[model samples]
Target: MSAGAPPVVTEIARPWWDALARGEVAVQSCSSCAGWVFYPRPFCPSCGGRDLAWRTVDPAATLYTWTVAEAPVSPHFAHLHRPVLAVAELGIGVRVPTTLVHADPDDVRIGMALTPVFDAGTYPGFTLLRYRPA
Candidate 1:
Protein backbone atom coordinates (compact mmCIF):
# COMPACT_ATOMS: atom_id res chain seq x y z
CA MET A 1 0.00 0.00 0.00
CA SER A 2 1.17 3.51 -0.81
CA ALA A 3 1.43 6.10 1.89
CA GLY A 4 -0.95 9.02 1.50
CA ALA A 5 -1.22 12.52 2.87
CA PRO A 6 -2.44 12.98 6.40
CA PRO A 7 -5.84 14.35 7.22
CA VAL A 8 -6.26 17.76 8.80
CA VAL A 9 -6.67 17.23 12.54
CA THR A 10 -8.51 19.93 14.36
CA GLU A 11 -6.72 21.87 17.09
CA ILE A 12 -9.21 20.81 19.73
CA ALA A 13 -8.58 17.09 19.11
CA ARG A 14 -4.83 17.15 18.63
CA PRO A 15 -4.33 16.40 22.31
CA TRP A 16 -6.49 13.29 21.92
CA TRP A 17 -4.01 11.84 19.43
CA ASP A 18 -1.13 12.74 21.70
CA ALA A 19 -2.88 10.81 24.47
CA LEU A 20 -3.70 7.89 22.17
CA ALA A 21 -0.09 7.68 21.18
CA ARG A 22 0.57 6.87 24.81
CA GLY A 23 -2.22 4.21 24.79
CA GLU A 24 -4.41 6.23 27.10
CA VAL A 25 -7.93 7.61 26.71
CA ALA A 26 -7.83 11.32 27.35
CA VAL A 27 -11.55 11.84 27.97
CA GLN A 28 -12.68 14.92 29.77
CA SER A 29 -14.02 14.47 33.29
CA CYS A 30 -16.00 16.99 35.29
CA SER A 31 -14.42 18.26 38.43
CA SER A 32 -17.69 19.51 39.83
CA CYS A 33 -20.07 16.62 39.15
CA ALA A 34 -17.55 13.94 38.23
CA GLY A 35 -19.35 13.12 35.02
CA TRP A 36 -17.01 11.60 32.43
CA VAL A 37 -17.23 13.09 28.95
CA PHE A 38 -16.07 11.48 25.71
CA TYR A 39 -15.53 14.33 23.25
CA PRO A 40 -12.83 16.39 24.83
CA ARG A 41 -14.08 19.79 25.91
CA PRO A 42 -13.12 22.54 28.29
CA PHE A 43 -16.31 22.46 30.32
CA CYS A 44 -18.41 19.95 32.21
CA PRO A 45 -21.67 18.99 30.56
CA SER A 46 -23.42 17.96 33.76
CA CYS A 47 -22.55 20.92 35.95
CA GLY A 48 -21.50 23.54 33.41
CA GLY A 49 -18.24 23.95 35.25
CA ARG A 50 -15.12 25.21 33.52
CA ASP A 51 -12.76 23.14 35.69
CA LEU A 52 -12.91 20.04 33.52
CA ALA A 53 -9.78 17.91 33.21
CA TRP A 54 -8.54 15.03 31.11
CA ARG A 55 -9.16 11.63 32.66
CA THR A 56 -9.06 8.03 31.61
CA VAL A 57 -12.40 6.33 31.03
CA ASP A 58 -13.09 2.67 30.58
CA PRO A 59 -12.73 1.87 26.92
CA ALA A 60 -15.74 -0.34 27.58
CA ALA A 61 -19.22 0.91 26.69
CA THR A 62 -22.66 -0.52 26.00
CA LEU A 63 -24.39 -0.12 22.68
CA TYR A 64 -27.34 2.10 23.54
CA THR A 65 -28.55 2.35 19.90
CA TRP A 66 -27.63 1.80 16.25
CA THR A 67 -28.69 2.53 12.65
CA VAL A 68 -27.95 0.93 9.27
CA ALA A 69 -27.01 3.56 6.66
CA GLU A 70 -27.77 1.25 3.67
CA ALA A 71 -27.43 4.23 1.34
CA PRO A 72 -24.23 5.79 0.10
CA VAL A 73 -24.21 9.26 1.58
CA SER A 74 -20.73 10.15 0.36
CA PRO A 75 -18.77 9.45 -2.79
CA HIS A 76 -15.77 8.24 -0.78
CA PHE A 77 -17.94 5.75 1.11
CA ALA A 78 -19.70 4.27 -1.93
CA HIS A 79 -17.01 1.72 -2.69
CA LEU A 80 -16.70 0.57 0.93
CA HIS A 81 -20.32 -0.47 1.13
CA ARG A 82 -20.37 -4.15 1.89
CA PRO A 83 -23.64 -3.43 3.59
CA VAL A 84 -22.00 -0.31 5.04
CA LEU A 85 -23.50 0.88 8.32
CA ALA A 86 -23.34 3.32 11.24
CA VAL A 87 -23.53 2.58 14.96
CA ALA A 88 -24.50 4.86 17.81
CA GLU A 89 -24.21 5.30 21.61
CA LEU A 90 -20.73 4.61 22.83
CA GLY A 91 -19.23 4.65 26.38
CA ILE A 92 -21.31 4.64 29.56
CA GLY A 93 -23.29 7.76 28.84
CA VAL A 94 -21.62 9.20 25.77
CA ARG A 95 -23.46 8.95 22.47
CA VAL A 96 -21.35 8.81 19.28
CA PRO A 97 -22.54 8.05 15.78
CA THR A 98 -19.89 6.36 13.60
CA THR A 99 -19.24 3.61 11.09
CA LEU A 100 -19.37 -0.06 12.07
CA VAL A 101 -16.65 -2.43 10.93
CA HIS A 102 -16.06 -6.24 10.78
CA ALA A 103 -19.70 -6.96 11.53
CA ASP A 104 -22.62 -7.91 9.35
CA PRO A 105 -25.21 -5.22 8.77
CA ASP A 106 -28.05 -7.67 9.44
CA ASP A 107 -26.56 -8.41 12.84
CA VAL A 108 -26.83 -4.88 14.19
CA ARG A 109 -29.41 -4.03 16.84
CA ILE A 110 -30.22 -1.40 19.43
CA GLY A 111 -28.94 -1.76 23.02
CA MET A 112 -26.09 -4.08 22.16
CA ALA A 113 -22.77 -3.74 24.03
CA LEU A 114 -19.68 -2.44 22.22
CA THR A 115 -15.97 -1.79 22.77
CA PRO A 116 -13.34 0.35 21.10
CA VAL A 117 -10.84 -0.68 18.44
CA PHE A 118 -8.26 1.92 17.47
CA ASP A 119 -6.82 2.38 14.01
CA ALA A 120 -4.37 4.70 12.26
CA GLY A 121 -5.99 5.24 8.86
CA THR A 122 -3.95 4.27 5.83
CA TYR A 123 -4.63 7.26 3.60
CA PRO A 124 -5.42 9.85 6.21
CA GLY A 125 -2.87 8.68 8.78
CA PHE A 126 -5.01 9.59 11.73
CA THR A 127 -6.40 7.67 14.67
CA LEU A 128 -9.90 6.20 14.34
CA LEU A 129 -11.88 4.49 17.05
CA ARG A 130 -14.11 1.67 15.85
CA TYR A 131 -16.76 0.05 18.03
CA ARG A 132 -17.14 -3.69 18.37
CA PRO A 133 -19.89 -5.82 19.90
CA ALA A 134 -18.81 -6.56 23.43
Candidate 2:
Protein backbone atom coordinates (compact mmCIF):
# COMPACT_ATOMS: atom_id res chain seq x y z
CA MET A 1 0.00 0.00 0.00
CA SER A 2 1.30 3.41 -0.97
CA ALA A 3 0.25 6.78 -2.22
CA GLY A 4 -2.29 6.54 -5.06
CA ALA A 5 -2.78 2.87 -4.34
CA PRO A 6 -6.09 1.47 -5.46
CA PRO A 7 -8.52 1.06 -2.64
CA VAL A 8 -9.52 -2.43 -1.69
CA VAL A 9 -13.13 -3.29 -2.48
CA THR A 10 -13.96 -6.79 -1.42
CA GLU A 11 -17.23 -8.46 -2.44
CA ILE A 12 -18.49 -8.52 1.13
CA ALA A 13 -17.62 -4.87 1.67
CA ARG A 14 -18.93 -3.58 -1.64
CA PRO A 15 -22.05 -2.06 -0.12
CA TRP A 16 -20.05 0.09 2.28
CA TRP A 17 -17.75 1.30 -0.49
CA ASP A 18 -20.63 1.92 -2.88
CA ALA A 19 -22.44 3.98 -0.30
CA LEU A 20 -19.37 6.11 0.31
CA ALA A 21 -19.03 6.67 -3.43
CA ARG A 22 -22.58 8.00 -3.38
CA GLY A 23 -21.78 10.44 -0.57
CA GLU A 24 -23.36 8.34 2.16
CA VAL A 25 -22.31 5.91 4.87
CA ALA A 26 -23.59 2.40 5.27
CA VAL A 27 -22.90 -0.13 8.00
CA GLN A 28 -23.92 -3.68 8.61
CA SER A 29 -26.61 -4.15 11.22
CA CYS A 30 -27.49 -7.35 12.97
CA SER A 31 -31.01 -8.43 12.08
CA SER A 32 -31.30 -10.54 15.22
CA CYS A 33 -29.87 -8.38 18.00
CA ALA A 34 -30.21 -4.95 16.38
CA GLY A 35 -26.52 -4.30 16.95
CA TRP A 36 -24.39 -2.30 14.56
CA VAL A 37 -21.29 -3.65 12.85
CA PHE A 38 -18.43 -1.83 11.20
CA TYR A 39 -15.71 -3.32 8.99
CA PRO A 40 -18.41 -5.33 7.25
CA ARG A 41 -18.71 -9.01 7.96
CA PRO A 42 -20.92 -11.91 6.96
CA PHE A 43 -22.31 -12.56 10.41
CA CYS A 44 -23.17 -10.45 13.39
CA PRO A 45 -20.42 -10.32 15.99
CA SER A 46 -22.94 -9.47 18.69
CA CYS A 47 -25.31 -12.40 18.39
CA GLY A 48 -23.43 -14.61 16.00
CA GLY A 49 -26.42 -14.32 13.69
CA ARG A 50 -25.99 -15.10 10.04
CA ASP A 51 -28.50 -12.50 9.01
CA LEU A 52 -27.10 -9.03 8.47
CA ALA A 53 -28.13 -6.10 6.37
CA TRP A 54 -26.63 -2.88 5.10
CA ARG A 55 -28.18 0.17 6.72
CA THR A 56 -27.53 3.80 6.02
CA VAL A 57 -26.35 5.78 9.02
CA ASP A 58 -25.82 9.44 9.69
CA PRO A 59 -22.24 10.28 8.92
CA ALA A 60 -22.01 12.53 11.93
CA ALA A 61 -19.68 11.41 14.70
CA THR A 62 -17.90 12.62 17.80
CA LEU A 63 -14.17 12.60 18.04
CA TYR A 64 -13.19 9.71 20.28
CA THR A 65 -9.46 10.25 20.02
CA TRP A 66 -6.83 11.53 17.63
CA THR A 67 -3.14 12.01 16.91
CA VAL A 68 -1.17 14.18 14.55
CA ALA A 69 1.42 12.18 12.67
CA GLU A 70 4.81 13.78 12.80
CA ALA A 71 6.04 11.32 10.22
CA PRO A 72 4.72 8.31 8.40
CA VAL A 73 4.09 5.59 10.97
CA SER A 74 4.59 2.92 8.39
CA PRO A 75 5.55 2.48 4.79
CA HIS A 76 1.92 2.10 3.85
CA PHE A 77 1.28 5.65 5.01
CA ALA A 78 4.54 7.22 3.91
CA HIS A 79 2.71 9.59 1.57
CA LEU A 80 0.78 11.31 4.34
CA HIS A 81 3.30 13.84 5.59
CA ARG A 82 1.37 14.99 8.61
CA PRO A 83 -2.11 13.56 8.76
CA VAL A 84 -4.46 13.93 11.68
CA LEU A 85 -5.46 10.35 12.31
CA ALA A 86 -8.52 9.95 14.41
CA VAL A 87 -11.13 7.56 15.69
CA ALA A 88 -14.66 8.86 15.64
CA GLU A 89 -17.54 7.36 17.56
CA LEU A 90 -20.92 7.39 15.85
CA GLY A 91 -24.20 7.88 17.69
CA ILE A 92 -24.91 4.17 17.42
CA GLY A 93 -21.61 3.42 19.26
CA VAL A 94 -19.59 2.18 16.34
CA ARG A 95 -16.15 3.74 16.12
CA VAL A 96 -14.69 4.49 12.72
CA PRO A 97 -11.02 5.06 11.97
CA THR A 98 -10.59 8.13 9.79
CA THR A 99 -8.51 11.20 9.20
CA LEU A 100 -9.58 14.55 10.51
CA VAL A 101 -9.54 16.99 7.63
CA HIS A 102 -9.96 20.75 7.20
CA ALA A 103 -9.07 21.67 10.75
CA ASP A 104 -6.01 22.70 12.63
CA PRO A 105 -4.43 19.88 14.61
CA ASP A 106 -4.12 22.16 17.63
CA ASP A 107 -7.91 22.60 17.65
CA VAL A 108 -8.78 18.91 17.56
CA ARG A 109 -10.12 17.68 20.84
CA ILE A 110 -11.79 14.68 22.40
CA GLY A 111 -15.58 14.74 22.21
CA MET A 112 -15.57 17.36 19.46
CA ALA A 113 -18.50 17.06 17.07
CA LEU A 114 -17.49 15.91 13.62
CA THR A 115 -19.08 15.98 10.19
CA PRO A 116 -18.46 13.73 7.25
CA VAL A 117 -16.20 14.72 4.41
CA PHE A 118 -16.79 12.49 1.40
CA ASP A 119 -13.33 12.61 -0.16
CA ALA A 120 -13.97 11.64 -3.73
CA GLY A 121 -11.25 10.80 -6.27
CA THR A 122 -8.39 10.82 -3.80
CA TYR A 123 -7.95 7.12 -4.28
CA PRO A 124 -9.00 7.03 -7.90
CA GLY A 125 -12.08 4.77 -7.84
CA PHE A 126 -12.80 5.19 -4.18
CA THR A 127 -14.28 7.92 -2.03
CA LEU A 128 -12.72 7.92 1.41
CA LEU A 129 -14.69 8.99 4.46
CA ARG A 130 -12.94 11.75 6.36
CA TYR A 131 -14.05 13.97 9.19
CA ARG A 132 -13.86 17.62 10.18
CA PRO A 133 -15.01 19.74 13.09
CA ALA A 134 -18.70 20.39 12.91
On TM-score, the candidate that comes out on top is 2
Q: In angstroms, give how far residue 116 of model 1 lies from its true place.
A: 1.6
Evaluated against the true structure, the overall lDDT of model 2 is 0.89
In angstroms, how far off is 39's CA in candidate 2? 1.4
- Listed in order, each prediction's TM-score against the native is 0.76, 0.92
The per-residue C-alpha lDDT of model 2 at residue 105 equals 92
lDDT of 2 by residue, 17-98 (tens): 9999999999999989999988899898888998999999988999999999998887778877689999999988999999
How many clashes in each candidate?
0, 0
Question: Which residue pairs clash in candidate 2?
Answer: none
lDDT of each residue in 1-134, candidate 1, tens digit only: 23334546677667777665565556777788888766767677777888877766566556666566567566555555563344446455666555566767678677776767665654544665667776
